[model samples]
Target: MTRLVAANRVISTDGKEIKPGVVELDGERVVNVSALLGERPFTEWLGGTINLQYYADEQLCAYKDGKML
Candidate 1:
């Protein structure tokens, strides 16, 4: 099943806060990225626990650690 993860900030491999984006996943594969302008597979970043930050009303909301954020 495909799932959507809403996040305020995404930590890159270089440990940088990228942008507020949505990550779409089909199981372990990242099928889409909202910050990035195309639909592609991010295979390297797959199959691991993803740390995500959530925001509500322009404020920090929650932090999650999991495969689906």
Candidate 2:
């Protein structure tokens, strides 16, 4: 699986602008988006906490143990 991460702007709850500097992903699918919020180390590292993002799939791929659906 391959994924790409980039920066984008979004409107925050406080009506401020936020940036998702890095987006965590799994195999051409987005698993989480880390916004530029929270404390220094956290924000500086993974950028921010994980906020979920979704990708289009005809069927959800779920796995159990070490198998692929």
Candidate 3:
């Protein structure tokens, strides 16, 4: 996951504050990010649990923890 903001402004909706902008993805699809990395600053957020065990043939294998989820 990666977060980016336009210049100095953060992305917001409905006057709700969302800072540090981020993009969360599952496989190739995007998912919720605000609740996902709520604890870290948006500019400093990284997927909390990632265990990439392999990289081959331009493919990757990753894990969040034991049992694959």
Tens digits of per-residue lDDT, candidate 3, 43-67, equal: 4333344333333453333334332
For candidate 1, the C-alpha RMSD (Å) to the true structure equals 11.3
lDDT of each: 0.47, 0.38, 0.35
Which one wins on TM-score?
1
Q: What's the distance in Å from true for residue 67, model 2?
A: 30
- Which sections of candidate 2 miss by over 4 Å? 1-4, 10-17, 37-69
Task: Look at candidate 1 and tell me the lDDT of residue 34.
Answer: 54
Looking at model 2, which ten-residue stretch has the lowest summed lDDT? 60-69
Please, what is the TM-score per model?
Answer: 0.43, 0.32, 0.24
Runs in model 3 lying further than 4 Å from the true structure = 1-17, 35-69
lDDT for model 1, please.
0.47
Candidate 2 lDDT by residue in tens digits, 1-69 = 534343445332244544754544465444444454534232223222233322255422222132321
User: Of models 1 and 3, which has the larger lDDT?
Assistant: 1
